[model samples]
Target: MTLNTKKDPRVAVIKTGTTYPDIKSRFGDFEAWFIRALSGNLDITVVDVAAGETPDAPGNWDGIVVTGSPAMVSDRESWSEATADWLAQAVAECVPLLGVCYGHQLLAHAFGGEVGYHPDGRETGTKQVERLAASDLDPLFANLPRTFPAQLTHRQSVLRLPPEAVLLARSAFEPHQAFRIGQCAWGVQFHPEFTEAIMGAYLDVQSPELTREGLDIDRLKAELAPAPEASGLLQQFSDLVLQMKKD
Candidate 1:
C-alpha cells in the first residue's frame, strides 16, 4: 500500500538485509513485531536499501525506523552510503527515528560517530539495560523501568557518538547501547522488538555459528527472558513518529 492509504503520518522502515534461510529473518520478525506494537495505526512504508532503492522525501515521512542488518556499518557497501544519506536528510528534516542493532551503528556513522568490530566478537544474549540519562528524564524513558531485560545480539557498536547525540542507555558490553539524536530520534543497540520465542528459534537454528564463536547458548536464551511490559517501549517508538507529525 502507498502512503496515501491513511491520513495518519507514514512511517518509513528501512530494511537493510536479506531474510534468513534457516529461521525467521530479522526483517520478518521486525515487521511483524513493529506492526503489532503499532496496532495498525500509522501507514508503514518499507525501503529495501540493500536491494538498491533509496528512500524518498525524508520530510514527507513522519518518522524513520532503520532495521538491523547482517552487514557491518564500517564496511564499504553500496547500501551503506544510501541509508547514511537518508539519515543526514532526516536529521535536517527533524524526523524522529528508531534505529535497531546495525541501524544504531549506521546512525552513529552518518553523524560522525565511530563504529568498529568488537574484538570480543559478538554478544548474543539477553542483557539488562541501564538508563544513563543526563537529564531528569526523557519522554521515551517516561514509563520505562529503571532496569529491564533486552535481547542484544550484535557485534559492532558505536565507539563514540555524534556531538548532537545523547546517550540514553548502556550495558556492560557496550557503552553506547542507546542514544537520541537531536529530539524525537532514538537508536538502540538491543532488540526491543525481539520476542523470546522468536529469539529462541533463531538461536536454535543458528547453533553452528554460536558453537563456532563459543557463545553461551544458555545465556543467550536467558537474555530473551519474558518482558510482559516490553511491548510498551515498542509502542512508544511508533507513537513518537506519529507525534512528530503533529508538529
Candidate 2:
C-alpha cells in the first residue's frame, strides 16, 4: 500500500549530487535498496537539491536517508550550505537518521567537526570492519557480522566526530567507519547499500580523482569486484528505521 502522507513511514532520500552525463543520480544503489528497505510499501521520493528540495514532506516523513555527494565536504557552496541545513534540522527534530558516505561527512560537519581529504589512499573496494563496543551496543548492526564486508568509496572521511557521537564500527583502512548519537542518529563511512556494479560505475566517474590522489583504479576495481554483504547491513538499517518509527 502507498504510505499516505498522513500515515505510514515516509523516508526522504536526499540526492546530494547529479551524476555526470545524467546517469540517473540516485546514489547508484540507493533507490533499489531503499525500496527493499521499505518492503516496497512506504512512500519514497528522491529529492534532488539541484532541482529542488524534497517538497516539504517532513510532516509525511518518518525518517531520512541522506545520500553521499561526489563533491568535497569542505567545499563552501550553495548546495553544501542547503544540505548542511537539512542535516541540522533533521537532528534538531530528532528524526531517525541514517547517513552514508558524504551524508556521514555532512553530519559530522554540521554537528561540530571537520571532514576533509585524507592522505590515506581512497577506500575503493570491499573490506571487513572490526566491531567495537559501539557496534555491540547498537541495534543498527543487529543481523550483521562482527567483521562484515562493506563497500568503501570516498576521498574524505570523518576526522573527528560530534562530541555526542558514539563510534559503531571500524577497519584497518578507516577508523571512524560507523557511529551513532543519542540513540536515534547513526552514520556510516562505508556504503552498506552499494553493489559491485554500481561501485564500478562510481569508480569510473571518480577515476580522475583516484589518479589525482595517486592511487590505482585497476587495483581498486579488482578488490571491489567481489560483492560485499551489504544486503544484510541494509536490512539491519531498515529494521532500525522501522523500530525508530514505532517508538
Candidate 3:
C-alpha cells in the first residue's frame, strides 16, 4: 500500500524484554521480530525500556508499539513502572499505540485495569481468537475474520478492562485477549510478531514447564501453524500511522 505522506511516519518500538538465549541466537529478539512484521514503510526506532532507556516525549513519534516481555506486569519493577507511565502519557496524547503480550497487560495496568495471573493457568501455542462485535468499529480489527489463529504464550492477563476500554477479541483460554482504550490505543494478549518457527522454538524452550503443568507439548507442537491474519496487524497499524500523518 502506498502512503500519500511527504515523510515517512516515525514509529517507536518500546522493547520490554529479550528472547531466551537460544531463541535469540537463532531467531533474533522481540524488536527484530516486530520490525520484520511491520515491514519497511515507516522509520522505526527501538527503545530498550527494559534496559533503562528513556524515550522522548509521546508526541515526538507518529506511532508506538510495545513488545512482549518475559517480565510480569504485576512485578512493578522500576523500569516497567516508568515505561507504563510513558505509555499512559502516549495514550493521553492520542498517539496510535499497539501493545502485545506483557505490553498488553501493562497498558491495562496503566489505565486502572486489573492484571494478574490467570486462575486457569498459562495459555501457550497456536490458538483461535474470535473477534467481538465491537471490533466492527475498530480500525485495526474491523477487516479481520470473526476468528483467526494467533501465537500465544502467557500466564498473566488483564483481568478487568479500564473504564471506556472496548473489548475486541477473546480466545478459549483467555477472556481478555484484546482490547482498545480510547481511539488510538490497543492491546493484544497474543503475539502478532511470532512466526511458526518462533512459536516452535518457544514450545521447545518451554517444554519442561508445559510437561510440569500437564499441558501436552506434543499436541501444541503438532497444532503449530502460520497466522497471517494476526501477523498482518503490524502492517495495518503501520499504514494507519502513515495515513494519519498524511491527514
Predicted structure with the largest lDDT when compared to the true one: 3
Off by over 4 Å in 3: 1-7
Report how far off residue 112 is in candidate 1 (Å): 0.6
Taking all chains together, the TM-score of candidate 2 against the true structure is 0.83
Q: Give the runs in model 1 whose Cα sits over 4 Å from its true position.
A: 1-4, 25-29, 228-230
Residues 1-247 of candidate 3: C-alpha lDDT, one tens digit per residue: 1122335688889999899999999999899899888858788888898887888899998999999999999999999999889999999999999999999999999999999999999999999999999999899999999999999999999999998799999998898899999999999999999999999999999999999999999899999999999999998998899899899
* Model 3 TM-score relative to the real fold: 0.96
Model 2, residue pairs in steric clash: none
TM-score of each: 0.90, 0.83, 0.96
The candidate that wins on TM-score is 3
Model 2 lDDT per residue over 122-228, tens place: 78767777778656767776556777777788879898888888888888988899888766677888876676666677778888988897888888777775434
Q: List model 1 lDDT by residue over 20-130, tens digit each.
A: 655454435455565656637788877778877778788878878888878889895877877887888898778878888888889888889998988778877667777
Please identify which of the two predictions, 1 or 3, would achieve the higher TM-score against the true structure: 3
- Which 10 residues in a row give candidate 3 its minimum summed lDDT? 1-10
Kindly indicate the candidate among 1 and 2 with the higher TM-score: 1
